[model samples]
Target: MPLYKTLDPNSQTHVKIWKITETYEDLLQPLSLKPESLERVSGMKSELHQRGFLSVRHLLRAFGYTDLDLYYDEMGKPHLKDGMHISITHSFTFAAVAISDVEVGIDIEKQRDKIAVIAHKFIDYEFDYLNKYADDYIRNLTVIWCVKESLYKLFATPGMLFREHFFVIPFTLEDEETISWIDYKGQKCRFNASFLEFEGFTCAFTLPS
Candidate 1:
C-alpha cells in the first residue's frame, strides 16, 4: 500500500506511516538504494524485516526524499541530508518515519500481552499510576513502551538506560498525550510524548517540551 497515514503536529514536523502489503520484489523495484543498503537488506534473515526496510524508504519518498538522502549515525539514529531531525520505526506489518526541525524520535509497537512480562525491564515511575488489574492495563503498558522507546531514540545517547533515565508522567488512553523526563547524571530534560493507536498497534513520538 501507499502511505497509510500522515500526521503533522506543527508546521515543521511530519510523521508518515506505511502498511507493508507489497511483496519484496514489488517494494524493491521502485526505489534506488546504494550498494551498501542493497547489501544490508539482502543479508536480512527474514523477509518481514526486508520489507520493513523497504517500506521505510518508500516513506522517505513520500516526503520528497530518496534513500541516498538518508543516513545514520554511529548510534544508529536516522538523519536527513538537509540537517533535519528524523526517526524511523517498523514493527510487524507497519513502518513509520518522522522528520522535524527540532530533536525528535518516533516508534511503533504492536500491543501484545507479552509486553507485561518485560515491563520491569524498561518501566519504573509509570508503575505508580498503572494498575495491573485494570481493563486497560495492557494498552497502557504498550503506550508507555512506545513513548519510552521514542525518547530513547530521540536522546540517542550511550549509557542511557530506560528504567534508570526515562520517566513517563501519568496519562490515560483517551488523552493520547503525556509528558516524559530524562533524568540521568543529576541532570534532567523534559519532552512531550504523544501517541495514537490503530490496528492494535501504538505509535508514539517525542519532541521538545
Candidate 2:
C-alpha cells in the first residue's frame, strides 16, 4: 500500500510514500505496459530501480495521467512535459516521491543505532551542533543523515559531503521539521526538512524555497 502525506509549506505539492507490498509481477503490471518503457522496466531487478518506475506510474494514475509522459535528462533527473518537479527515493521495503512546482527531495531510512559509527564521514561542523544533544543521540543523528541525503539528491551533486556542504539548523524533538541549507562552493540553497517516525524507521524530505 502507498502512504500519502502533504507538507504544509506549499499547497500545490504532494508527497507519496510506498511500502513494497507487492510482488514484481504485481507491481510491474507488465500486461498494462507500453512496449518501449516496458522493455526498460523488464531489464532491472534492483529494488530501487523497479520502485522508481512504479512510483511514477502510481503518481501518474493519481493525477489522471495515463500515458506515462516522462523523460530523463543527461543527469538522469526525471522531468514531466506538463511542468511539475519530482523527487524519488526507496529503501528495502519503502519508496517515496514528492512532486511540486518547487524543487523537492524525499528520503526514507530505517532508524538504526549504528549511524553513530560513521558520522564523521558525512558530518563536519554540524557535529558541534549535534554534540549539544547528548540524549536520544542516535535518533537525532539519523535525522541529520536523512536530511543531508535528501539535500544532496535535491542538489543532484555526486561529490557532496553531508557534513561539509550542508547544515541542519537546530530544532527540538517536538518539532517535526527543521531548517537546513547547502553551502556548496559558495552557492547557497535553503531547504525545509521534516521527519516522521514510522515503525522504527525515520523518513525525511526537503523542499527547496
The best candidate in terms of lDDT = 1
- State every prediction's TM-score relative to the real structure: 0.98, 0.84
Residue 204 displacement in candidate 1 (angstroms)? 0.2
Flag clash pairs in model 2: 122-163
Candidate 1: RMSD over Cα atoms? 0.8
Kindly list the per-residue Cα lDDT of model 1 for residues 90-135, writing each as its tens digit.
9999999999999999999999999999999999888998999999
Which TM-score value belongs to model 2? 0.84
lDDT of 2 by residue, 125-201 (tens): 76766763587677788888889888877778777778788899887667989999998877887888988767667
Candidate 2 at 191: error in angstroms? 1.9
The TM-score of predicted model 1 comes to: 0.98
Candidate 2, residue 32: the lDDT equals: 56
